[model samples]
Target: MTAFQQQLLDVNGITLSIYSAGPDSGRPVWLLHGFPECWYSWRSQMTALAEAGYRVYAPEMRGYGDSSAPEDVAAYQILTLCADIQGAMDALGHTDVCMIGHDWGAPVAWHLGLLEPERVSVLGAMSVPFGGRPKRPAIDIMREANVGRFNYIVYFQEPGVAEAELNADIERSMRLLIGGNSDVFLHPKPADAQFLAGLDVPTTYPEWCNEQDFAVYLRTLNKHGFHGPLNWYRNFEVNWQSTEFLAGRQVLQPTLFLLGEDDPVGKLEAYTVKKMGELVPRLESHVLSECGHWIQNERAGRVNELLLEFLGRHYPRAGIV
Candidate 1:
């Protein structure tokens, strides 16, 4: 595998730390990591794709890692995040590249289809499913649905509330969140719901994210407080308002969607599967067994296989340098 290259890129008025590898001439494939995760989250897949002869670009995202984290919650809106991707593309002078996103990144990728389907060659998402826009804002709906329950997204609505809980203990938060923190309110079971279940979140850490891997996340988040990451969840309504017109818009890109059987987030909305297929006309769905929310980590090998197959099908790596 080629050694990873690190650089700070100026994009969308923010300086982003991007890690990339593989041949510069190889077909470009950008990988996006979700909340609480850095480009390192795609370390395994980066090597896999890079070795498969595709240039891989993974950024720490605006709010995470060495990247710039703006204080305003509005700065973290969906359109801004999408601009970051486009800005990176313009900076890199590349277009028609495939995007693979996990967790929060999934929605960003799906939104790209709505925002600029022509900009993307294809799309792949994990953990989160793309259902059409809601009748009302999502946070409003989540508050009512998870009433007296431990819904993390709803818990994240209030400012400083989740930050206080998460910033108080970074390491513990990383451990539980990675493996579903089955005991936390983030888990579907109401019996385990607590005010801030992320507080008791030290029990389960997925194999891929061991003590060493988690240390990287802890140190990174410690450098940049939870304010920026938490701000991502804080912008639910703003993002809803920005892209309100695109509501119920169908994603025409050829897409591949993957999920873990044990992911509680997958069960949050019952309409994801039906809606995903309906919106993403050309969709290939796969669910890995014994996996949790972290599908790319838990099932790295299989995930790479699927990605290579899909990318190879659309953008053949036969003649590219």
Candidate 2:
């Protein structure tokens, strides 16, 4: 693996801390992390891709880690978030590049492709797949789907409650998320139950995530507060409005969808995947067993294998230094 360096770039009034590796002359790739996670999430991929001759940049994203954290909720709107990615691209002066994202970052990557298709080469998403916007209101869709255990999304819409709960017990929160602390976050259930139950426990990770790593997340989120990250959920209406025209927009670029079979987030109804496939006509889906929501960590080897193969298929390495 090649050595990666950390640098800060001031793009569009926001200063972003970016971790980058690989050859300076190689094709550039940007990896975006989701909520409750920072640029560290892509540490493995950054190393591997960099070694494979791609210039990879993984940013902490605004409101996470050493990046700017604006207090206003509107600051985290989808449009602005999309601009952050574009701004980063512009700052690097890269006209087009390979883009990969997970969870919240996946949606932003989707928006980036839609808003500026010419700027993106190929797309790779983990855990979350594109299903366009909800046809009916999200509430109506949830109620109709009989999604009982996943009530946290609706609860998060209330504001203050989740932040309060998460802040009250950072260790406990980390425990629930990583399956390290008492195997529970708030309630008493098996370490795996929280994830399998389909609740939006951002902290509920697997055992590989320990105290040292959890503290990194807690420190950043606690300092920034959950409002900015939660704002991603609050922008459903805005996303819906902006993406209405994308009802049947096809993502023509080569795409990859990686998920874990045990991932509650990935265990949505069949229609969701169907809708995603319909929208992204070129999507190739893969599901790994014995894995959960944190697919990248739980199944790094397999994820790396898939990513390497996909990139090779689309952008073969020819005669390049």
Candidate 3:
């Protein structure tokens, strides 16, 4: 595996800690991680892609690890998140890139495809799919759908409430939250339920994440706490309202979407795949059987294979010229 070179750069008024590998001359591949996770989440894929001669860059997305965590809730809005990556790419001097993201990062990647089609040569997203900008604020939609139930998004709407519970015990929170399946969010809970109320803390880590990997996540959350991350969820309505200009815009880039069969998020968002197809014309998608939310980590080998195959076809290293 190629050793990662870490650097910090001021982008979009915030400093981002970027972990990069592979040759500087190789085609740029930006890996954006989701909430509660740092750049370390893409360690396996980073190694594989770097070894395959594709320069890989994974950043500790705002609020995680060494990246800047702004105090204001509005600072974490979706467009601002995309702007952070855009600025990072500008700082790196890369105009064209193969951009990929997972979970919350998926939305950023998808939006960037719309916001910068010519610059993002190819796009990939896992776990989450873009179904186009909603007609109304997403918070309103979630609230109506989750009425009389405990929806995590709705639960995260209150500023300090979820932060208090999640930050109470960083290690325990990381353990239970990462180890648990997506059903925790998919299934209905009482309206008064807390985020980590009844989840069990695993004595041993999952196969994809060992004690060492677990330690990295623990140290990260303990550093910045969950305020910045939870702030992401708090901006659902804000994101929707601000992105109204993208109402009918489609992400015209050659795209790939991956999902895990067992991921309850897939169940909750089954309709999105179809909508994504309508919104992303050149999209190629897949569902890895028996996998879950942590698609890249849980199925690193297959994910890398699919990514390499997809890139070789549409955004190959040799095609950069």
Candidate 2: clashing pairs of residues: 176-204, 177-203, 177-204, 177-205, 178-205
lDDT of 1 by residue, 1-321 (tens): 469999998888999899999988887788888987888889888998889888899988888988999989899998898899888988888767888899888888888767877778689999888887877788888788767656777767777888887787776666656644544544454623444552544464667888788888787788788889888888878888888899878888888999888777777654776567877888999988988777898899999899889888876665442
TM-score of 2: 0.86
| TM-score-superior candidate, 1 or 3 | 3
Residue range with the least summed lDDT across 10 consecutive positions in model 3? 180-189
Q: What is the TM-score of each candidate against the true structure?
A: 0.93, 0.86, 0.98
lDDT of 1: 0.81
Best-fitting candidate, scored by lDDT: 3
**Which segments of candidate 1 are over 4 A away from where they belong?**
185-205, 318-321
In model 2, the Cα lDDT at residue 138 comes to: 66
Report the number of clashing residue pairs per model: 0, 5, 0
Q: Model 1, residue 236: what's the lDDT?
A: 77
For residue 18, model 2's alpha carbon misses the true position, in angstroms, by 1.6
Candidates' lDDT values, in order? 0.81, 0.73, 0.89
Residue pairs clashing in model 3 are none
